[model samples]
Target: MQEYADPVIDWLDGGRGYFAKKLYRESCALQPNGSYTKDLSLVEEDLSRVCFMDNSPVSYNWNKANALPIEGWTSDPNDEALLDALPILDSLRFTSDVRKVLGIRGF
Candidate 1:
């Protein structure tokens, strides 16, 4: 689970970084342990992060459009080759958001 959780954290942080830099569509990735049977709290936290709303450095989220230039690792770590891992993240993020907004409650 940590393997998945760690990557999710990195992706969230990266997406938040991009969003902060005003790179909207560029910021997206998948969450680990995301499913109909997963923990609701974790899922909510993950969604909030992708939406650029989470504030914790451990999490990640949107903040001020057009942030300053970054120094490293903007490229997708999951695949510096294909960049196809991002949409999975985006979909998971959106799913969590929809579930929360719709008051779907727990798994």
Candidate 2:
């Protein structure tokens, strides 16, 4: 938790978590009767503003991989406890998916 403080500090001090308020404004501008041109411009403006202030640019590379060995392990799961927890984790995932399908509010 101590490691998480700097970003929190940066956020509260003159940062664009402040400008996230503009997301609502920009969203409103996209309404049917709003200026279509200005709406689009505000959308892009908010997006760039967010990316700039947050330093998370639009581009990213994603990847997937198969197996990886742990420091002193021979195979996946590594121990009995991880193997035991797998089914519980899978059940929680299924429950989450079911909640999503049912339009559960706080998911």
Candidate 3:
């Protein structure tokens, strides 16, 4: 049997277990009716910083692959796991509760 490391498991092991919160915060920040401006790049940069804070290698790989590090998982176009995660990925958006939990300055 071919062994494929589960991305989710790898992500958790990478010490970015709270990536979901980051993702939600970014989503909220980028929302049209949200507090922050609609600059996706700024949010992406922050998200990248979160990954870099956890593991340099993962951050390098993520940037090299030109993939968005969403919810601790690299959104690689060639990765089947990423493709499978797309559906539920949208559900990771930020809500008022999530903003409060993350202590996001802006709603």
**Largest lDDT belongs to which candidate?**
3
Over 5-96, each residue of candidate 2 has an lDDT whose tens digit, in order, gives 24443544455443333322223323354321123234343222221111111111010011111122233444554344335334433542
lDDT of 3 at 107: 12
Please report how far candidate 3 places residue 20 from its true position, in Å: 19
TM-score of 3: 0.21
Would you estimate the TM-scores of all the predictions? 0.24, 0.18, 0.21
Show model 3 residue runs off by greater than 4 Å: 1-41, 44-57, 60-79, 94-107
Ranking by TM-score: 1, 3, 2
At residue 69, candidate 3 shows an lDDT of 35
Instruction: Give per-residue CA lDDT, model 3, range 1-107, as digits (tens).
Output: 00222454455457855443332223323334333322323335543232221122233332332233333335455656454544433333533222232232221
Top candidate, metric TM-score = 1
Question: TM-score of model 1 relative to the true fold?
Answer: 0.24
lDDT of each: 0.34, 0.28, 0.34
Clashes of each: 4, 0, 0
